[model samples]
Target: MTATLTGVDVAPPAAPAKRRRPVPGWLAVVPLLVFTAIAFGVPALAMLNGAFTVKDQATGASSYTTGNLTASLQGAYLTALTGSVKLSAVSAALGTLLGLPLAQAVVTSRSRAVREAVLTASGVLANFGGVPLAFAFVATLGNAGVLTVHLHLTDHGWDLYSFWGLVIVYLYFLIPLMVLTIAPALEGLRTQWREAAQNNGATGVQYWRHVALPVLAPSLLGGLVLLFGSAFAAYATAAAMVGSAVPLVTLQIADALSGNVLVGQENVALALSLDMVLVAGLVMAVYLPLQRRSARWLA
Candidate 1:
């Protein structure tokens, strides 16, 4: 027998039909795809073509060849490549080491104003690079500079055009960049975790060693990769300060294109650019995995 309630509505309320977006999901991504194609893809393909092609000055004809890549890997070019790698590694390592503690201080600070002030300064300083940065260092540390003359720094063998001087300049921006990169990860450290560690009779050092470091390892390594890439790809400051005194791949690339040292080596510049792209790609490969790992832990 069927029974009906007098004042009841039991039809599941029509299940609240799903709302459709006015635009397709993929439509929103079209602009980004086009931009990437024009900006990165086109340039990359052009570089590849140029790197493998040789133009004859006599006949005005172009021929495909691998000699550009070969030339890029030998003699002075090889030295520049190695020097860039070394400089990048050193600056990135030092930046990470110094920035970590500073970020920790910001995170653990009791005063909000102090934290804000430091972070604001770091943000400004991190983006301070290129020509202005080089000039500032030169005026303060260069030969016949204010500090160099006033403090007898030149008397003590301080040279702003040297490799180490370039490293010091790189550290100026890199440390702040590291601080900015790693701050959010530092903030993600749960207070409950610290409290739990303390409740278990763990010392501060023990807590950091056994718990915090393991969690923060990914973020730290990721920051190092970022700094390495920054130092590796830097052009302007080094070009301005050290010029050709330091053997950097970027300088070599510039010389190749501008014929500063040799004429008709434009294709060689493309080959060097390709090498830089590969190095940058390697850094990205290492960074992506660490970033994903950090997101899982810190998120």
Candidate 2:
């Protein structure tokens, strides 16, 4: 070491920095891309192909036509579609309304255990569908079911097989799903915004109307549409609970797929799928933009 300017000596220069490994970029996404192509893309293409055609089984000839779609939209099929839409809409609306408060509760709760428990339960409940869920509801409320037996509910003319009972069953999962979707949106709301509103002497309702509602509107709408789609595509639970009694679109599709109906039912089933896809795509088109706008505030 050498002294400099009759003072202390400094150390030698430091070694060069090591470069970090470059991220895997698109490779990281390849697995999901492959899975999507297999699961969603394949089925979508198959449905599109099947929807707009008729195949002559004996002659091995295929012809394109819109007749399948036409048949799908007319008569009892159309009624089923309408019923599904109405059910989905009612459930989505109810879920969104009820879930907002639950989400806000979860978000605002001071206890870590409360938040974790709610979220954990929400995740499980959202996915708890199909035969088991339907069977459970039936056992709890169906004719001569547990509650029905204990309370003599049938004397009151309450029918669990009816549309209203189905709606109640749907709410179980729908509300939890809505809670999960809306929770993040609620958390995205800055505390500063609430404080700012309070600083201006705004009441709770006033704050919600002028500030929080506008910010949350997109998220809520997105969640609503998603809920609608969830209810629309649901098959097993509806099938198991009410069976042929409920003329929902999914049940009709299942009937057609099972070859239990007239000729050309296969294409008709696919045509129904196409209709559902169009509705889902339309909702997604609306949802994406809203989600992006919501992200701006959150970001």
Q: Please write out the lDDT profile of model 2 over residues 120-232, one tens digit for every residue.
A: 99999999999999999899999969999999989998888878788888999999999999999999999899899999999899999999999999999999989998998
Report the number of the highest-TM-score candidate: 1
TM-score of each: 0.91, 0.87
Query: Which numbered prediction scores highest in lDDT against the true structure?
Result: 1
> Model 1, residue 77: displacement in angstroms?
0.6
Q: Candidate 1's residue-wise lDDT over 83-164, tens digit each?
A: 9999999999999999999999998999999999999999999989999999999999999789888999877888889999
Model 1 lDDT, residue 268, Cα: 94
Model 2 — which ten-residue stretch has the worst lDDT? Answer: 255-264
Cα deviation of 49, candidate 1, in Å = 0.4
Candidate 1 ranges with C-alpha deviation above 4 Å: 1-22
Model 2: residue 162 alpha-carbon error in angstroms:
1.7
